[model samples]
Target chain A: MKKIYLALAVFSAVAIVIGSTVLSVSYEPLDEVAERMNLTGENLLGSPFPEYTIPGFPCWAGGIISGLVGGIIVFAIIRLLMKVGEDGGN
Target chain B: MHIPDGYLSNKVWLTCYAISLPIIAFAYIRLKRKMGKMEVPLFSALTATVFALQMVNYPLGPGGTTGHLIGTPMLAIIFGPDAGIVGLSVILFIQALLFGDGGITTYGANTLNMAITASLVSFYSYLLFRRAFKGEKGRVISGGLAGWLGIVSAALLCGLELGLSRATFGYGLNITIPVMGISHAVLGLVEGVITGFAVYAFGKYKPELFSR
Candidate 1:
């Protein structure tokens, strides 16, 4: 019980630090490392690399929401999956 | 690292899917067998924790680029690799489907690098080092090295994938492998420290989480 609270407190603190752009500096996505180089995409089959960052929510908001919402979703789904497994994949 | 779409050639991506699918299935099977004691609260907490942590991109010194935690190492160190793999797979799935952080096409590759490989390496390395060392301080040090090794191994695998994706990424093995490997080697230090602290914290609070 104490561990849970500690974990949540730590998680929320991390979420706030990373989610708030003011607190954390943003870095370029790793995939784009190629873009910064002299190499051109024309050599590859897909000429233009795609951008796949999160949409809509800011980092902090998304972090908090996912932590809260994802916890419930993951628990329910994992439980359901276990039940199905016990039922022989019915 | 999350390899986006169009970064991997069909051959590379497909091969990754083929290789990763079986391993993930095995992890799932293992997870199910132990589901009763699976510790969903901790797993979910860590999953969301890592999900948010992955978003925090730290600058990689003067390289004009950045890196973030792969995190499976810490999870593996605490809860064993099987749970670590399962949890990371879930995080990557959400990141791809909802956040667009990774690609559906590249998921296999991403999972292969960040989850499966990272957890395995982290877990085994910890075991190996723990056996070689003793006491509380040694355990924390072992955890740190295991974390470093895990992320570095993932980076190396990512480099290999990108290197193989010369037909798709326009970078040959020489370019992609070294960049990914070297940069990650540096970034892995941070992983090592975090993993060590995680080991310390867990040992102090939830010692039961550590597997025998």
Candidate 2:
């Protein structure tokens, strides 16, 4: 039963993204057809449908490297804080 | 969100795992220390509740952002940080495996972001606020503040991670980071309220939970 809820949530989220994308695509061409109803390009990209393309290898590479490095830094900081707290007995 | 397959480079997932291992081990040790055989049901039930709640997502404009209210920090305030981490990780794991909310590979990163960070931040902030207020209200306020801060903090850190990935991959950090960050901030505010209320209510009803 709970699993069903989870599935529904994930499905709806995906649907929302897809619906937004469809709206954006539909609107993108409409501007050319009807400039007066000009729903701005920025709005199409920013809200509802985020502008996402298949990122090239560069984006993937950067994200991986950054995620690992940042994770380490955060881990170290958290460790230090924990050690201090343990020593302080709090 | 679950990191979809191929959404992130292998290095990112590896790094997240590398960092998460020790923290997870520590959490396990902490849980063992506090565990009572009878409490398993209570914990599992709580985990289910968190998972179910987090699954519900309200729409965000054209894009839909839906999920539980994200109350990890509040859990930590009442159940100690390490135990809090355990509870959160369990929910994330269940979501990934059962519901497919997050990607399998991205589990490490997602756990680190949602559970590890929020739990610790809430624990520490609560301590600080408890000292500042020097009373019961202090505890309540701390719970809410920590809950709010924990969610926002996770959102910001997630943005930073995304931005860095964009930079490393040459995806144009200028575009991805701001977009992710702004969306999360708006979402986080709503999440924060939910988290804050959860913590405040728990503290009121079960003050004994926060006493420790």
Interface RMSD of each: 5.9, 14.5
The digit string of per-residue lDDT tens for model 2 on B1-212 reads 43433444567767877877689778967765575444444344444445434533455422453333565776677667886787777666544543344556667777787888888887898788778875656665666677767765665555555445542333445654554456556656656565556566556655656667
Q: Candidate 1: which stretches are off by over 4 Å?
A: A23-29, A37-90, B35-38
For candidate 2, the per-residue lDDT at B158 reads: 54
* Candidate 1 residue-wise lDDT, B1-212, digit = tens: 77877788999999999999899889888877774444765666666677666656677633666778878998888877887788888878766765556778888999999999999999999999998877789889999999999999998999899888887677788987778888888878888998898787877777777646
Which residue pairs show backbone clashes in model 1?
A19-A60
TM-score of candidate 1 versus the correct structure, residues matched by position: 0.85
Tens-place lDDT per residue, model 2, A1-90, is 354344434543443344333322221111221133232322101211122122353433333333233223333433333344344453
Query: lDDT score of model 2?
Result: 0.54
How would the docking of model 2 be graded? incorrect
- Cα lDDT, model 2, residue B136: 55
Top candidate on lDDT is: 1
